[model samples]
Target: MDELVRWLGVQLDADKARAAQWHDLECSIHEHQEGGLLKAVAALEVYGEVPGAVCDCGGPARVLREIDAGRQLLALHLPTPYQDEGDRWPGCTTCSWRDEMDDLQVRYPCKTVRLLALPYADRPGYREEWRP
Candidate 1:
């Protein structure tokens, strides 16, 4: 079995016209609507200063970057999945746990990254009212 499959995230074009629709799709795909795992898409931006202070990862921030449209933007893949089977996944950045949220937020800004609940069997595994 492919190992990265469990840590996969898709980067789709963000359509201004279909922002909500794309988000719904993102929720379906990245969150592993099937039985794989959660995925994420991030838009890269370059700034002179830190976006915000994160609980120092015991080291300096790992400034990562990705290329799009022939331009390099600073971004990194979120190390977590966003869905689960039987409504329970493993790991903090990968599970649907309340405490897991803090782990992600500290590294990836909540506003910049989104959590989609794509589950297997063509069903979404997210709760709109649930905040974690």
Candidate 2:
């Protein structure tokens, strides 16, 4: 298999595991409903700034951008497969704790460059709640 595909598979597995944890703790849902992993991965964003802090891989950290779109924009489009499974994916951004989000974003450029899970207060539910 290609490196990027392999990397994505690993990332997906980790994300799915995280979703299971969240479901057990918060949602009380058991099955791996579609988009569960995506929702969990999207919720891992850090909002504030940190001075003199480098990524786990020793690279400069990328700060969060002002996202005008909804928090669950990515979730709106579920079941979207890898753009080109045959093509090699991009390398990880070299962050700690298996944060290949940047790499995934780069690989799927058409999705959205700005990734931030801002609080959608006015709404009555979480992004995953409205999965269609």
Q: Per-residue lDDT for 32-114 in model 1, tens only?
A: 22256544422111212345422222211121122131111113323344444444323334222345444322322121233
Clashing pairs in 2: none
Best by lDDT: 2
- In candidate 2, what are the lDDT values of residues 21-128, reduced to their tens digit? 432123222233255552221211321234433223211111111121222343342333444355454322321122355324423222231122223323332334
Clash count of each predicted structure: 9, 0
TM-score of each: 0.16, 0.20
Candidate 2, TM-score vs. the true structure?
A: 0.20
- For candidate 2, the per-residue lDDT at 81 reads 46
- List per-prediction Cα lDDT, in the order shown: 0.27, 0.29
